[model samples]
Target: MICLYIGTNTGSCGLITAQKDPVPLKSVEVELEVRDHVATVVSTLNYENKEDKPLEAVFVLPLPGDAAVCHFSAQIGQTQIVAEVKEKQKAREEYDDALSSGQQVCLLTESDESPDIFSLCVGSLPPGESASIRLEYVTELAVQADDGLRFCLPAVLNPRYQPQGSAGAGFQVTSVPASLEPYSLSFSARVSSPRPVSKVESNCSLDPLQYLNTDQTQATVKLAAGHKFDRDVELLIYYKDAHQPTAVVEAGQASAEPGSLMGDPVVMVSLYPEFPQSVMSSTASCGEFVFLMDRSGSMGFRIKRRSLQTCIHSAKDTLLLLLKSLPMGCYFNIYSFGSRYEHIFPKSVEYSRQTMEEALKKVKKMKADLGETEILEPLKHIYSQPCILNQPRQLFVLTRGWVKNDKEVIDLVKKNSSSHRCFSFGTGENTSYIFINKISKEGGGHAQFITATDKIQPKVMQSLQFALQPSVIDISVTWDLPKEVSVTVLTPPITSILQGQRSLIYAQLTGQSSEAAEGCVTLKYSLAGHPSENQLHFSLRPAEDTGLTVHMLAARTLIRSLEMEARDNKGERDEEMKKVVEELSIQSGVSSAFTAFIAVSKSSGEAIQGPLIPPPSDFWHISAALLGQAQNYHDIHVCNFLITATESELSVKDPLLQLVSLLEASGCWLLKPALASVLGKTSKEVANLKPASASSEVWATILALIWLHGFKMDAKDEWELLAMKAASWLRAHNATCVTECVEAGNALLGCRVTKDALGL
Candidate 1:
């Protein structure tokens, strides 16, 4: 007989066997197993008594309701039997309750060919022995917004005895909309075993600038993935007028693809405006005139021994033209100066052919005396005369060079702007023409350098025209704009336009206009009759919708205009040029890469070859020719040549030397540097033929020797030879210091000895 002991408890349940009872005793054990999506258990039993006795037992375990029907198998003797049954109805009830409360479901595949379903299983073991069983089934899943519908795949624990445990199965249900067309987007979904999946839809819109100006503008829109997107977009453009329909033009576009590392997209729009062609003309008139000429000792120096005949001829010709063109009511006087001022034309004369002819004859007979050029005394003398101030007057000054008192003359001119316009004519190589030009600008007038005797007539006419043109005598603007609002005029005043010429005023405005009710600008001017004024109204809103983009476009435009104007020689000011150069320099912190200097060449129709090297002989001759044509030969032509020849290797001899001689005879010291640079490197033979110490040539040679010593070149023997020659020449003249010459010679000898020791 066999006896079995059974114990049932909530936490622990088992069967025990009792021994020595004349009956077979048996014990059974059960174990449960659980995985990612399924759970299962197995049972075994053992017999402890020798006498075999029949054993009976019952097994129970929790089951998942969604699981498929449970299958049971038993191995007894050599026979095997399998039974299948549905899971406990109570498990289903529990699952239904949990699902109703928003719990998720897990489903498994019954087999490779089956869909996902619920599954469960149970089995028994023979007495006093161990056996394996198989349970194959599927699981059911629940669906929710967050919890997508899915199934678990069935897996096998023991292939030979227990062929199936649970099959792997998964399905994805998208909670996001399939296509978000209204929002311009699309959606998709996917699943990797054991989890639910979902996705949101998105897309780019075709018409980007839906709200843009329809008549004159169009745009396109694009979409990207990041929180911040950066891309270059294109814009289609059109033009519209109040009376006409819009005309479309295809504009270019840029693209920013997905996953691009660069951030943010930029949109660029271009617009065109219709502008009328500009035509310009000018006329100049003089009511009263004063001619101030420099008659310093230097002027006595002759060009080709003709006493600046070319210059005098040009001046006479210019004066003749002015006198002939002067209205019959006009009057003029002539004043010449050197160490002191003198009245060349003793009294002012009314314009007449006879008067003019006599004045021309008088000018021809005039000669410059050798005296220091002091410009102040003559200018003061004219300024002190109250009779000239009763009516509008003009001052015409001619000079071969600048005096230290130039600033004083400029100041006086500035003070006299109410009654006078001061025009300056720079004549020769030694003259500070640049300074003269600056002074003229400051004095509300113009400056012209006479490059040749021939240029004098045209230049005078131009200067006169500039002086006579009626311009904006004064400009004033009044606006009722919000406090702190800023306004700037974009166009400069046109001073050379005719008194009645129509002109336009353009300005840019910034800041809010709401604070003030209205805004207006007042422009005051002087015309032929009398003073006049004009008014302009300001817009209530800002001129530009996008400040940054407009500013960038403006800057680019300005830069291009500036570069173009810098290369143009027609004497026109391009408002955009300086602003562009300055802005670029400020932003990039770089010095200007190139400096512009006017270079006219013989090859006028073709580009000049080589870098802009200093002017050669051809340049000097051409420049001289231009000057002569202007009738400013004695003064302006020589000045232009000196400035052009400075630091040039070609300036070392011949024409340059001759030019320097002319300048020195005019008492011009400005050309000393160029002469020094040339003579410093010339051979001893060349140095010996140079003028003696008492001559200005000697001063140039001394300065040259000083420069050579300062440079300290490697050719010691060559420098010594030049130095010995200079010393000998200096000793031949009582004008030079022997001690200084000896010191310089000793220094050269020492350098030669040092170089010889170094085998150089």
Candidate 2:
């Protein structure tokens, strides 16, 4: 007698019987065939000995299709018993194969064999075991397209034994290449296992025009996996519209024809993210400069052991260089402001080698005093000065955004527009955009917000370049268009179009012209009593879409400007700015503002602390949310969050702390000594409120320490004493603390911290 037992889920099957001398089978074979969507599998076992010895034999079959049948017979002492076993190999194989071929593959396996479609049989075998049989097949790629092209591959697997749903078996699309034809690319695949029912659909077309560049020189294609298998393939190509150019060329070449002029000229102006160094250098020498610095009580904040002293030194160094570089006859003056305004040097010192050095020395010797930030008083006083009364001068105002009567200062700047231009620089996150923008607009200049002290030199140089360039210039464009056709031009204000440099111009045209109509556009610019013009033309055709990409490039430039502006005004809110940012985000599809918002919103109001550490995600949310708030007061809280978050994120060893220290130094220069004194008290109170053993509160303590240290004077005053205490605490607690922080602390303390001490 022969008996068989199988553990289906565990894949363990065995045979048992009562036999004396039964010969073993050498091999077991299973074959599966599918016709008209129906499949069947047959198993056969061959044994060497056929004597009636009650032999027990066991056979394993491979599954290929979704449904299958297993038939077997048992021989027991000259008696034969036959039975059937239902299998799901065919269905499973088809699903797996489809997936491998990059087609959608789905499989559902069941543990119980309830229906009697499969067979269970056993026979006695006496000899050696036979090798197990396995099945394999290849998968094909499936392509689909309606609006766009999609390539898919299917996966293949054996049917006799259904795999677990999570089993690592499936198809993947290996490659999709661009097609030579103008329409679409085709997909090909390879399969791992053979399935009875497999199908490949042809004549699928993907829209190639959708992926083509505006100039039709290049196209992009995407490939994806289907079910179970993966294979790589090449793309086919077909060209359409032979008139289209095959490559990108300079604007003055064949690419700049009348039809191409509809788009803005693409110029390789910058290789990096920053403005050109040459532009900064050349622009810095165009005009004269007058330095207006604040020396109020709030300016007593110590940075690197000197309160505002390092900033003064830095400014003096920049001025010395500027004076040396200025053209003959250019003039400047040094003015310091507190509750009152006073000229450190004469009202207007003619630019010369010796006078520049003398002025720099005088700037270095100046000191901060206890007084309110009366910003407008200095401007009014300068306007009244006889030496500057008639001369055109650029006023460089450096201060913290804590001025009383800011509106008066703005009005005075507006009243003196023809004779003066004001470039305002603020050191901390507390810089008021409202005041900066107002002064800049009224004085016909630009505002610069410097959060990092070290970056101030470069930023000031850039601003000076813009100021030196001609302010009043005109640009005129004349283009040929169909009658009633409309057009619009977009570009940055140009003081003058430089020779050998590309000037960008954006224009949009509408209304029907004759098919393939051509016209010319002339651009004339007037600058400093000189005039120049350039002409470009375009050929127009009526189509669902035109091949103009100039707007895209122009939009990118605008977006770049807006992003810089947003970062500069880090702690302020302006509706006009918000609108610009949103527009840029929509146009570019890359929104730093939106990403920042998402990052912050996810934090759920957690205080993000940074510097030597990375804060939790929630801290980012609160910081972004507070930064975006409309009120300045609320935004100040956001700056606090950022400062705290930085401390938490960075260790004393982090190099980024050096940047923070520089910013702290600049803040000392901008803030009045009196305000610094008050902030110190507030910071101390906040530190005292925190409980002991709270490592989380360390960021707050650090901020308080910085605030107190920032207001200390160089003399042996209470603030100086507090600053020393804070510096000692930082050095003791933060192992990564370096000499830079110590120097910054000293600078904030109004000490003569040198550039060498700052490692600048």
Candidate 3:
């Protein structure tokens, strides 16, 4: 049975639930269309209720942090409902009323606090009835350091801990083995660009690309059907000509009023402004560089497939490079935070040979031992300190983006913007794009991802260069259009613009123009105390059948501005603001913080009666869930299962070795780093390999127990049989080694295993 695992038992991590009797969602499919640098995605979910009673299911999931949801629709048999936007509470009330009245109702809303989170509620499905839901959203793609347009589909949403007395956080469904979920996924994408498409790359497998044109600028690709939902689906699209400015105009939606924003023509302008090389080369040598490092548990997540190194090591290495590169006279400080924070010195100190050496010593020895990812309190302390005169303060924050109160953190940064220019570096399986972007934007800085090894040093060095470069100021965009045409700007006014950075501006065309017409826009800014301008001209002809992407994207930008304003005016959620937001959301067919999409199956007259039960999102944010392993981990080379072993040769007594016999049948481990050291060497060169010795028996039994406790699965009763035999053998022969081996394994792996849990 397909199970709809939702809110029945979630404390709030955004994972799916599996109850005794649950509604089943059968299939998930996503279609993505890319134009220039923006992408619009449509997702469809199918659910069937086999139970005799009615079912109400909740699907909680994560979207791209910058996504703007524009459409929601549902179909059940002959009945189909298109959703309309309303105030969040009003939408909920309408959904509850429709559900209680025996009607099929659905509601979709973005998380009030976390922009990356969203929830879809499908209510009151009658027994044996099936429903199919579809949602569409648009987001602008981010340009990577390598000049690739990066697009990621987040299938995993980890749990967030809400602070006490704060607005309650949404619950997340826990993840399980992907194969056990029994849901299938299909994904397809189409690409169109002005520049020639070089290639498409991803960590996941994909079908061969098919080009519709000879130039290779237009193409389509699909994910291989057997793909597992184990990690963020990432796509890096490269263009032949890396840097160029372009403008695109799209036709309006036909169904809307001719003069309205939805129906009027729209234009999207992207510029990669060039700065004078002679002036940009004159970078400053004096500034205060404060480094905040993440020592949280998540930082231990390994980015390299086979290396023993984790993200923390890379972060530390980055810190070393940054510290060494700092100017001699500049002041610097290092603060590492998890639950609480600490500083390398009592206050900011000069970058001298002595201090640099001391800091390097501490940086090399730092470990990811902090309890949780708490960064707010440390930031407050940092902001409280005074900035040195004539030397501006530059904050370099490296974090895993695990904190729950993102709004609070954002507010703190905005408040401290005047004193410090913040540069953010995010690290994780999937970097926290929302938090890092907001932090950099509000603080007049730049945000970069340090997730991969290839871009780590270059991105850090580039950001450092930007930090040291004279700041660009007095930035503005001016448009010169046809005399009779009037333009309604959708994006907020330009505040901060950087050199070599690509930025997008969206606007609507209200009045008609001559058949053969063109318009121009100029970007004016002052750099290195000199005024500069860059201009572009493009035809005013509207591209046909562009859907409502640009208009909805415009609405989303407006909604975000309103939300940020509201953050500063907390407890002042007046009726006028609510009215304005609701109107915009409704007119654009988009969802906002205080707005949601609700629909009811009008053809169904009676509501189904049953207990109210909700579940999690259709997809997951797969951090490291066990799924799609073709071979038993225990039998494979230890390095292949988890950490790759190259430098350290593993010994048989290595506590992690106890894992070999333990999971030989089940999938979880191979052994340890020590094992990998001898992986390729001749057997004679390795130690402790014999038929059966007294030490071997004890060590095998103990190591097997450690594996069961550290990485055991619920099913696989046969593995449990092996475990029982190991325990019996230990009890009869060497029970004393049990506790010792467990402690040794836990110490090496940085985990906690209790005696009781180990069945001692």
Backbone clash count for every predicted candidate, in the order shown: 73, 138, 39
Model 2: lDDT of residue 575: 52
Model 1 / residue 655 / CA error / Å:
28
Q: Is candidate 1 or candidate 2 better by TM-score?
A: 2
Alpha carbon lDDT of residue 488, candidate 3?
A: 80
Model 2, backbone clash pairs (residues 3+ apart or across chains), number? 138
Candidate 3 regions exceeding 4 Å error are 1-18, 21-23, 164-180, 254-259, 304-308, 605-760
Of 1 and 3, the candidate ranking higher by TM-score:
3
Candidate 1: list runs displaced more than 4 Å.
1-286, 297-310, 388-390, 428-431, 467-472, 477-485, 488-524, 530-760
> What is the lDDT of every predicted structure here?
0.35, 0.36, 0.69
lDDT, residue 233, model 2: 22
| Top TM-score hit | 3
| Decoy 2 TM-score against native | 0.33
Error of 1 at 134 (Å): 94
Question: Model 2, stretches more than 4 Å misplaced?
Answer: 1-288, 296-317, 367-372, 385-391, 400-415, 424-438, 446-457, 462-482, 487-523, 527-529, 534-760
